[model samples]
Target: MKPLKRILRILKTISLYALLLIYLSPFFFVLINSFKSRREIISNPFGLPDVWSLDNFVTAFQKMDFVSAFVNSLVITFFSVIGIAVFSSMTAYIFVRTDWRFNKVMFFVMVAAMLIPFQAIMIPLVQIYGGLNLLNSRWILIYMYLGFGSSFAVFLYHGFIKAIPLELEEAAMIDGCSRIQVFFRIVFPLLKPTTLTLIILNVLWIWNDFLLPSLVLISSSNRTLPLTTFYFHGTYTSDYGLLMAALMLTILPVIIFYAFLQKYIIKGVMEGAVKA
Candidate 1:
C-alpha cells in the first residue's frame, strides 16, 4: 500500500508540472521570439535568438503609441474599478442588511444578469448608446463597465458581507454613528480584503478588454493598449517580433498587479467560500 501511494504521489507531481509547462509554453515562446529578428522568428520560431536585442521593443513602442494607449487603459481601468467596488459594496450591503422584497428581487435579477453573455446584448448596446451619441467616449465606456461588472462584484460582496456581524454596526450606531457613518467606518474597513480582490479582478478585465473599447473608442487617441496593439500589428504586417513585444508590453502591468494582489485574491475566495 505504501509503495502504491508513493508511486501515485510521484505521478501526480509529474502531471502537475507537465500541465504547468504546457500552460506557460506560449508565454515562453513569445518571450524568446520577441528578442529575435523577423526573419529569425519565421525560420526558427522556438529557438533562442542569435543575439538578444531591444530592437523589437523600440519598434513596438513607437508603432503601438505606447504612451497614449497605456494612459487610456489606465484611466478606463481606474474609474471602472473604483465605480464597481463602491457601488457593488453598497448594493451588496443593502441587500444583506435589508429584509425588503424589492431588495431580494433586485439581487436575484442581478445574479440572473451574470448568466447573460456580453455578446448577446452588445449589438443592441451599441445601437442604443450610439443613437444617443454616447459612443466613442472613455467615460461612457467606464460607465458601461460599471453596469456589466457590478453583478459579479455584488455577488462576491454579498457573500462576504453576510459573514460580517450585525452587532458591529449596531454598536457603532449606539455610539452616535449614523447609518452612513457606521457603514463607512465599521463595515467598509472590514471589506478591504474582498475589495482588493475585486479591484484586481476588475482592473485585469478592463485593462485587457478589447471588444467593448473597440466599439466605443473610435478615435486613435482614445484607444487602449489592446486596440493599439491590433492597429500596430496591422500596420507592421507580419512583423512577428514586434507583435510579440507589443503583446508582452500590454500584459506586463497586469502581471505586476496580480503578483502583488494574488494572496489577497486567494484569501478573499477562501473567506467567502467558508462564509457561504
Candidate 2:
C-alpha cells in the first residue's frame, strides 16, 4: 500500500511539471528566439542565438516607436483603471446600501450587459461615438474601457461589500462622520485586497487590448504596444525576429505588474470566499 501511494504521488508530481512545461513552452521559445537573427530564428527556432545581439530589439524599438506607444498605453490604462475602480465601487456601494426599485433594476441591467458580446455592439458603438466626434481620442478610449469594465468591477465589489458589517459604517456615522467620510475612511479601506485584485485585472486587460484600441484609434500616433508590434507583419512578409522582440517588450511590464499583485489575487479570493 505504501509503495502504491508513493508511486501515485510521484506520477502526480511529474504530471504537474509536464503541464507547467507545456504551458510555458511558447514563452520560452519566444524569449530565446527574440535574441536571434531572422535567418537563425527560421533555421533554429528552439536553439539559442549565435550571438546575443541587441539588433532585433533596436530595430523593433524604432519601428514600433516604443516610447510614444508606451506612453499612450500607460496613460489610457492608468486613467481607465482609476475611473473603473472609483465609479464601480461607489455605484456598487449605492446598490448594496440603498433600498430602491430603480437601483435594483439598474444593477440587474448592468449585470445583464456582461452576457452580451462586445462584437454585437461594437458597430453601434463606433457609429454613436463617431457621430459625437469621440473617435481617435485617448480620453474617449479610456471612457469606453470604464464603461465596459464597470459591470464586472461592480459585481465583485457588490459581493465583497455585502460581506462587510453594516455596524462599522453605522458607528462611524453616529460619531459625526458624513456618509462620504464613512465610505472613504472606513468602508473603502477594508476593500483594499479586492481593490488591488480588480486593479491588477483591469490593468492587464487594458494593457493588452488590441481590437478595441484599433477600432477607436485611427491615427498611428495613438497606437498602443499591441498595435505597434503588429506593424511588423506586412502583407507579403513579416519580420520574425523583430516581431518576437516586440512581443517580449510588450508583455514584460504586464508580467512584472502581475508578479507584484499576484499575492493579492489569492488573498482576495480566499477572503471573499470565507466571508461570503
Candidate 3:
C-alpha cells in the first residue's frame, strides 16, 4: 500500500510538471527568440540565441512607439477597471441587500447579458458609436469596457456581497452612518480582495485587447501596445525577432501585475465560494 501511494505521488508530480512546461513553452519560445537576429530566428527558432542581443528590443520599442502605446493602455485599463469595480460592487450590493423586484429583474438581465457573445453585437455597436463620433476617444473606450465588463464583475461581487453579514451595515446605519457612508466605509473596504481580483482580471483583458481598440482607436497615437505591435507585420513579410520582443513588452506589465496580486485571486474566490 505504501509503495503504491509513493508511486502515485511521484506520477502526480511528474504530470503537474509536464503541464507547467506545456503552458510555459510558448512564452519560453518567444523569450528566447526575442534575443536572436531575424535570420537566426527564422533558421533555428527552437534553439537558444547564438549571440543574445538587446537590438531587437531597442528597435521594436522605437518602431512601435512603445511609450505612447503604453500610456494609452495604462489610461484605458486604469479607468475601465475603476469604473467596473465601483459600479459593479455598488450595483451588486443593491441587488443583494434590497428586496426590490426591479433590482432582481435587472440583476437577472445583467446575468443573461453575460451569455451573449460580444462578437454578435460588435459590428452594430461600432457602427452606432462611430456614427455618433464617439469612437477614437479613450473615455468612450472606457465606457464601452464598463458596459461589457459589468455583468461578470457584478456577478462576482453579488456572490461575495451576499456572504457579508447584513448586520454590519445595519449597525453602521444605526450608529449615524448614512447609506453611502456605510457602503464606502464598511462594505467597500471589506471588498478589497475581490476588487483586486477584478482589477487584475480587467487589466489583463483591456491591456491585451486588440480588436476593440483596432476598431475604435483609428489614429496611430491613440493605439495601445497590442495594436502598435501589429505594425511589425507587413503584407509580404514580418520581423519575427522584433515582433517577439514587442510581444514580450506588451505582456510584461500585466505579468508583473498578476504575479504581485495572484494570491488574492485565490483567496477572494475561495472566500466567495465558501460564503456563497
Model 1 deviation from the true structure expressed as Cα RMSD, one decimal place: 2.6
Is candidate 1 or 3 superior in TM-score? 1
Evaluate all candidate structures by whole-model CA lDDT and list the values in order.
0.89, 0.87, 0.87
Error of 1 at 260 (Å): 3.4
Residue-wise lDDT of candidate 1 within 131-186, one digit each (tens)? 99989999999999999999998999999899998998998888999887888898
As a whole number from 0 to 100, the lDDT of residue 21 in candidate 1 is: 100
Best by lDDT: 1
List runs of model 1 lying over 4 Å from the truth.
Answer: 1-15, 266-276
User: Model 1 Cα displacement at 67 (Å)?
Assistant: 1.7
On lDDT, who's better, 1 or 2? 1
lDDT of 2: 0.87
lDDT of 3 by residue, 18-85 (tens): 99999999999999998998899889999999988999889888888899999999899989999999
> What's the candidate order when arranged by decreasing TM-score?
2, 1, 3
Estimated TM-score per prediction? 0.88, 0.89, 0.86
